[model samples]
Target: MAGRKKRAGNPSPGPSGGPGAPSPTLLVRGGWILSMAPGGFQGHGDILVREGRIQEIGPDLPRPPGASLLDASGAAVLPGLVQAHLHLCQTLFRGLAEEMELLPWLQTRILPLEAAHDEKSIAASARLALTELLLSGTTAVQTMETVHHTQVVLEVLEEAGVTAVTGGCLIDQGEGTPPSMILPAGRALEAQLSLAREWNGKRSGRVEAALCPRFALSCSEGLLRECAAASREKGLRLHTHAAENKEEIRKVREITGLSDIAFLDGAGILGPATSLAHCVHVSPEDRARLRDRGVHVVTCPSANLKLASGIAPAAEYLDQGINLALGADGAPCNNRLDPWRETRLLSLLQKVLAGPAALPPGKALETATLGGARALGREKEIGALEKGKRADMVVVDLEAPWLGPGGSPETRLVFAAGPAEVRHLVLGGKTVVRDGKFLLWDPAEAAARAREELKKLLSRAKLPS
Candidate 1:
């Protein structure tokens, strides 16, 4: 918060229906609402937000007195995007390990740089990542933090008024390996839990903690079991990387003689509350076990492609009834953090793996919104534009060049629009991004700070070849 200055752009005309402020009510008039309901896309309707929850939705809704109307006439009111996996603090080293595999990338590049990065740099990266997400129409994100200083990231999230589940890196090694990045994993995890107690349920349940063990190879069975026990004790979700690349999977197999899912299941870690990121190398049996155990998979398409982590068979997972969500991973690997791009890329990747008929455009939209909400267990609160639900929605400006012929909104939304096309966005009935600008955060300063850190990080690491 220290480095961040007030954004130069004028704030969103002020929040509508604010109590102390002049406006005490708001009526969002005339918008093509993509309800995300069972049938999909309530193309012509309006949403009324009285006090941060939708009060009504229909044609020509009655505008209450003292109500300020958000003129969403030319936009599609879709649910705000949810990012199920990301290391926001890693924004400083996005392209550091462009060629190395996952384990080496972490051990040689990511871990060393992250360990060296000061607290100020970590906070700067977090702020920049959150600002980019807001501009890209993300309502919530499950962000991972460096083991030592997660509070800084949570602080940045609070300052931005974003919904997020945070995880502190859990590793059990010392020097020469990624676990060396955080020695004495137990103490590190304990600190994380202590911080969790302080910040988990803050922002009116908008933020929470997840027990994050970095990966199988980076941790010992004892450490993972301890983390699972802690998660059970706290009823917190378990967030971890699982079988992201082949080398990692091979290490787990050698150590345990079990595939990824079997290893986690045997460790007594897999559960309904588990949010596993990048199940690209998971086996068929692993997929079945994941479904049976109700494990949610958060697919990071952009990062997977950039890192060559092997595209996950997301379409097959969806067909098997496994819950799926979307994430961009982080800015460096993705070179950008935008859910709109993730949604499109995830679908197209599935198509590349399977066929054109697989992973349709509308399905991709669902993965980013509804599926993501389900993955985070925030089903009741988010994932749609409906009365009685939280006012978590994004307005896609339909005036873009791709939408000129007025094709299907699902196609246009997933394929055409990136962060640039997201003109206005709202999270929990508050204006976070309007006219393509942040309401409270200054992204330019945050980005500049991150770039400065990136240069130093790259210079230190052996570039992935």
Candidate 2:
């Protein structure tokens, strides 16, 4: 017994409540660990977490004194999913804005509804989105809120303990733009910078701010240039949509005498710190610019397909060495803020466009994890289950009958599993979801609040209730 590995002792009541509280030492044992790191996979391994970071990972890591024990037997442990593009403000609009293309969808439904959001409605929407995201195994996201009440959403994100980079959608000029939603260029930039100063690096870096110009068509050249300049000056990330739809692209070209990507580039918005969602209609030149400028492209397959937008060549983007990530977009467009569904669609769509060999299951998983982390510039901190990385991971129950036991863990996770199979979710070394239930928030209460807010929001917008 000289070389025997010591087993962990009994579970202890480790850390106290609250997101700012110190994390407890924890031992997660007996799971199939997918590190998503250079070490690859380990069977029935143990992971030690201390002070919100992964301390050690191996076949049998010794549990420290007074460490909490989480039994992960018959589970698959992988890095928590990251959503690179989401509209947390639109969660309450989920089934209300159906049967429309991209431009009409925004002009007719999304803009007015967004303009109607009060502080309570924004808080309810953020809570609803957060509930679905956490229960579905997403620990980090880059979300864009509507023009007003963004601080409410940021507060909700901080309280929920989800890692995020988010800010208000900047819209100043466009046809049918709600009057309340449009702010002058100078005022908009000043407001966003103020928010960044107040919230960026708050909660020990768990939450941050970004400069989000709504898009080329919705914002004037002046506002876009200002945002680009401020992004560099303040060292904040720039997020927006580009070339998502053919009609939108055409409109952008007509307005600016340049394609969406080219106009964004001319405005100085394309860079390594910027992430553009829905690059579904990029030209070859646009693709080259994206690759050359080291920009990130987030593909929202479900939203694209739902809105009848053409498929993005995600496999081709990967081949072109563009940093690619996955996202659910928004609840109104995608109808569900589920990263697993995005992971599956990210692969299956490629197979349809390219071939059977394109974008395998494992690579799709990487887009949701490592690729998303890179998009948010947090690859070194939170993407993988590696030592010294933040301990944000998901424990998925692999015993479902539909999952069967035949395929590899990655295959099962990408092709068969979903939110229903997520057994536990750990964020910053604390268990946020257990037995498929969210521990830090109440889904039922969130649902009720969303319903109330939706009704009031519809009345305010003068839409049918």
The top-ranked prediction according to TM-score is: 2
lDDT: which candidate is best?
2
Displacement of the residue 144 alpha carbon in candidate 1, Å: 1.4
**Candidate 1 least-lDDT 10 residues:** 1-10
- The models' CA-based lDDT, in order, is 0.77, 0.88
- Backbone clash numbers for all candidates listed: 3, 0
Q: What is candidate 2's lDDT per residue for 226-333, written digit by digit as tens?
A: 999998988999999999999999998888899999999999999999999999998899999999999999999999999999899999999999999999999999
lDDT of 1: 0.77
Off by over 4 Å in 1: 1-24, 39-41, 178-180, 452-465
Q: 392-432, model 1: which lDDT tens digit per residue?
A: 78877766666655778777777787777676677677766
